[model samples]
Target: MSASVKSPRDPSTSFDDDVWPDSTDVLIMGGGPVGLSCAIMLAQRGVDVLLVERRDFVFRFPRAHLLNPRTMEAFHDMGVAGDIYGATPAHDRWRKAAWYTTATGPGRFDGMKIGDVPAWGGGPDAERYRSSSPRAFANMPQLRLDPLIHRHALAAAPGRIRSRQEVVAIEQDSESAVVSVRDVVTGELRTVRARYVIAADGGRDSADLLGIELEGPRDMREVVNYHVSMDLSAWSEPDALLGHFLHPAGGARRRGTIQALGPTHYNRDSEEWLVSVAAWMVEGDPDDEAALFASIRRMLGLADDHEITMHSMTRWSYHGLVAKQFRDRRVFLVGDAAHKHPPTGGLGLNSGIQDAQNLCWKLAAVLDGQAPDGLLDSYQAERRPVVAWYTAHSLENANRHPPIAEALGFCDDEAAGFRGLEVFVSETPEGEAMRARVAAEVAHNAHDYSQLGVEAGYHYWAGALVPDGTPVPGDPSDPVTFHATSRPGHHLPHVWLDSATGGDGGSVSAHDLIAAAGLTLLTSESAAPRWRAAVAAASGNMPITVVAIADDDAAWTAVRQIDDDGALLVRPDRKVAWRAARLPADPDAELTAALETILRGGDAPAGDPAEPYLRRIRAAANVLVR
Candidate 1:
């Protein structure tokens, strides 16, 4: 049924003050990637979810162009990764970005060559726990991807996504959140009282009602983005998405041409091929598609025989801002509502998708009464800092002018700059190193998500899972460097464990094992007696899994024996909650303490190594020696 048809509100039926007839466990105020993702995950957990969008349909503008590995893993869980992969054309995966002097100038710089395969890893195995796949980024535009996810979310729960329904106001209390939405087409007003309200409204009209302010530079720069149809196959250039034009006079323009949409070529006889171009405007006429096309043709040195088909044009402002706060009572802001950044590094959409994944599980746990309210605080604690860091870094990146533009060889340092350029092009080791260093400086930027800690190494400092500052003897740096480690606040690094038990002979990832269940306890087999008892108690009381490892096993030796660590508690999100050298006298007390910390979102108890808990395990000696 069309979303414009509003559902009638009945006055005869009794409804709670905080909730209405169409009220659900979670009400998502945005049908973009973030909101849709939340709906997909919440529905999977059996929580009734409603996603409302202001637009009539998914937007077709290709805003975001990169999807990171972390987001891909989330899609894998939702069972739509394969569908997205199949629907996306192969050419879309092979992207090439470059820098140009102007809309019609020669090339100046090229994007760091991201190889064909994902730099970290791809596929189902990459999603395995403890498996930190090597691939980092994928070149997929949001215009094509958002629709796929929206369809999947609706399929997961039909009649849940209500487009053309704009949220007007929100009222929240200690019990629930009530949102008043209007059906734009029917002019009908309906109130939905939900257990939780998510503000994924992307800084549009809805976020304003919640008194959320997006603080940052609104107009850092103005960019013109448009999709145009033109025939340029005669140039015989490689099918690279990004092309750079450098005008001898000065100023530059970057064009991204999609030679083919997915696997199929545009019907040349009926419809022309499309290419997107973005030019930095100093000041001039906005509706200059003819001038833009003429510039492109001059840059490509093509004849005037090509026809121009202007599809859509949009003017956007680059603003890097984060909301004042992500949560205020039962209303929580996410995605663009939480943060917005420049498209320099293409981190905006990926960051929002991460926000959704981070918030969904916490919201579900709170609704199901599995976790305490404090868990929600981690969402802001973890993501807000990340958003701030990336935004700053992106602004820095955008401000960096190309070496060619800075030198202005034809002017002031003309001779020295030309000489330097000659030296830069030399084949000597120093020359090669100079060019490589410049490329490396641009490519290996500090935009590494690892630094933010939200994507990989974020640890809970104030909440229930804070660990006691016990000194475990192991290389702290190694955890962040070589492989994933179950360090406090860091995602447990993925490792391939022997899958002999499952008759697969292949390897299973650590993530798949621990993440399969809610909370997991990894303990030594020597402590199996106490561990099994604790497991029995925990199983009866709460959702938990206990994995016992023998002292002699190599895998156990590598993990448990390293710091003489006897056991480690992993949270549902795959972060370490607690650790001990040996089981406490009353295992339930320790288990309860750990569970309470996680549920309350408090740090684990702090204490000195109380002799037994601090004892070191010796494999050769076959004894726990303090």
Candidate 2:
């Protein structure tokens, strides 16, 4: 059966002001996807959460559209993926992206497909993702997504997120953070205090409050996004995908690329559309209404009298930046507060949601007294390097676009621009060369479309991860191709097992067996009883669950690359913290020591071989005592 779809903000439901407590365990700023996610995860963990958003309602604009597998897996873990899938109601074919010369009259130029992978699976990485997660990539407009998350956040913890509430000032010391919030409609102010705060509030303004500076390029380019509703049915084809790329045309002064927001098939009678006009703004105003409209109309091959209704126009500056520090004293940054990048691969929202996933469980553990305060230091140590890689990858994806334009002789920087486009479509030797180069460029950009490795292959090397003596595996040369493995410090490999099924007989991802907040132990049935006993004995304060498979489950064991008698310890985030090739002489002691090491941010028992690695992490986190 499909998951039931319901809005938490049903008219019958009530979210009164009293639903939130005066004081909370965690205070999250911003009610964007990241903040809402943090609130939902924290509330689900039984943490009192309060979230404040300056906006009165969720933004109803098309923003991030690509929800990668990892983000879907995180939503699945939160038990919201099905609702999100249901909310989208778009087919796999609609999710595919194609480049077009013009939306008004296509087929004159052959289409260049970009998003080749199926949205709901049957793509090249389908089996791998099927093994790793129960969820797949989703291409839903952010306008639809934000409400689902907003409703979920409120449902999980009613009144936790108060909209139209602006955070005025934040004061923090060694123990807690005091936040001053103001009512947007009424000039009322109230102060709330929490032991820890999450700056999920997007933009660099929040960072400024903490005296943090963003490091890296502040602006890559400026774009004007036009939300238009018009009769575009005449321009669409049965094979057209959601994304349409307008080739450079209309001479240098009038030449600019336009992206059609599609394969959104609005009803023909009431056709509505959204598109962005992007140009290198070296001179003149980027937001000149008359100029912007002409550029859009020309790119679409529309006549001067074409009827187009404009709803709204927003000018935005793209940035490739990361906060100099993710953490400052008692406050920690997440989402756009920590990093910003071009949306070439649609990693912004995905990374932000995962940032909440990474920090939520750790915060819960520490708050519950299952871990020490020092464990907080791992947040930056583990997330910074990932953000750095994503920033560079986003930059690379953005940089590759210019080469395609240059190869097509559409170099806007040159005195003669897009004049070669005529020759590019001709039957001459130069045209053939341009065609080959364009095809090669399109193929070379496969990573920008199917970024499985960048989305799923990033393994946390520090923070609460306990590295075994085994050497860590290297990532693929291509940032987007993933290799699943279960080495310590990496995500546990995925495998299908009948024991993971239920009365319905639907197969489950090994990941589904793990809980949202606990240590999961996987071992053979013969050792299951012992491991369970060890877990029971060792988990005096921490949460741990042990599962022992039958000795005949060789296939699953092989996927894990562990002996039937061996064991693997998985953290709450579905990452392998420690693994034993075989049961140690003292199972309880070994398991107990591993738990302690992880809770203490990779500390090891005296004489343990991993002590050196732990020391290095300590130095990087800056939490080591003199």
Candidate 3:
């Protein structure tokens, strides 16, 4: 999985359409994390998929530094969460973020703690809540992680993921998409026909090709990132990534260096550095290396004798944008292709990965004849709002400025300032209330996955798959915010339960339980008989698990109460397709209606054996060729 490994397939080689299958179930246009996740999900479901990437190999950029809990859950489902955990470099989970008046200014604030939770017990369930099993936010750089994902995708489907294949054109009719790709290294063109095409080509290329416009602020200022090697033990504090070198007088613009890269472990050999510096613009010849070198030297407090090694220089603009639509006909967009946000929150890559996961299961269900054709529209319905939410939130996070010290009631009068400090810390109710409010605000600011359930918890609220009731307030369209309560259409809350009901209290992880059940129908034991009977009627037609749980756990209890009769039917993609107090007598018919409502575009439901729809589509294509 080294970054230097080249593509195994020769550029001169063209996959012979006559020798192989004439069409693919899905064509994925980027081999990055998003596309790779899509490929893995499809291949896992036994779908014929073709994945192409313009890059010669896996990503080497130092982007996407953290993996939140929701993403960990996704990796768990993929069976690679452990591999990712093992590969990540060991580092302190709780680190500080420093902010300065300016990029070069002296530090105005100390370390600000982000995310940390205290342990309550020791077990898988405990780990799920407290242990950071999948890492709520880990510091492993994407340069090291992307290769692992790429390898996993290729391993998931041998001879499926094609590297160095640049997609030049995509055309789709009502039934299939034809894509033209050129081997970037060999200059050979090949046509691939697929039932669906996913464009993960980021914003620049795929957006333009699809005639999609990105509406948002462009880069008003250029930020330069440098990966460098240096010894900062003399001045740098441990675990401090941002160091501000404020102006001596404190009234002028401050400038400082942002630590963009760090060692996975504390090993001296493993130690590397990524520094970012920003300014309005470089004066006196923009290309002046001396100016850049001087900025680094001043920021780092470097001495004349200090040795330095620079790895790479990258320039990025602060572009915040979302595509008008994630899909146009058979072609769909995900990840950076659908949206781009400021990297301040490290949500871009993680959000993109979620996008892939959301789309993958629906695509698999449709292609595998498990779900109807209309099910595909829900992909856009559910994910587009998420992109918009994260983009706006990320922009807000980027723009947030630390509270000025003066705002803490400190005054110019030295005597008055001391009195103010005493009152602020002492028995004054106002002072105590202010302090508590500030602390609570800071804790609230800590980005927790409570909102993740919203992002990942998204349910289809539009098109044929629209859920019942007035769209749940803040359903998929609302901005993501941390809320402990589980709302309808939100990600099923993570809770540990006693897996062994008859014996002593033994707990199992929520993720493990869900995976074991395959497709979980969470409802009370009282409803199990009816649900089981309903599922039995559709026995040969659908494959799902009926999980009956007591209304003891808080989240599930709330879901049960609000959903009525404690019965909720969850799709394989972990979305709630239908929920009711009891299954109808004709359970198969009711289930069919729900499925058709979501997947059939209000057209009359398909007759028995939904397999014919998929078969007919493919068979008709073959007839056209004949």
Q: What's the TM-score of each model vs. the native?
A: 0.76, 0.86, 0.75
- Candidate 2 versus the native: TM-score? 0.86
The CA lDDT of each predicted structure is 0.57, 0.68, 0.56
Task: List clash counts for every candidate, in order.
Answer: 36, 2, 15
Q: Which one wins on lDDT?
A: 2
Worst 10 residues of 1 by lDDT: 617-626
Model 3 lDDT tens row, 238-350? 44443433322222222334554555533223356666665532335435665665666655555545666766667787666766677888888999998876665567888
* Model 2 per-residue lDDT tens digits across residues 1-626: 00111112222123587443456678888888899999888888877778888887647677776787788988987778998777553554444445555656533442322212332233464675565555677766676788888888878887667888888888887878888888888878888888898999885357668878876665456666777776655555443334445355422222233333443452222244556666642235555666666766666667766777776777777666677678887788999999887776778999998888888988987887767877777777677677766766766665555455556666443434345666677799988888788767655556676666787787766667677777655644466566777877678776667566756888766777676676688888898887877876775466777776778865576677787778988877888888888889998899888887777777423443223333333232232111
**Model 1 / residue 230 / CA error / Å:** 4.5
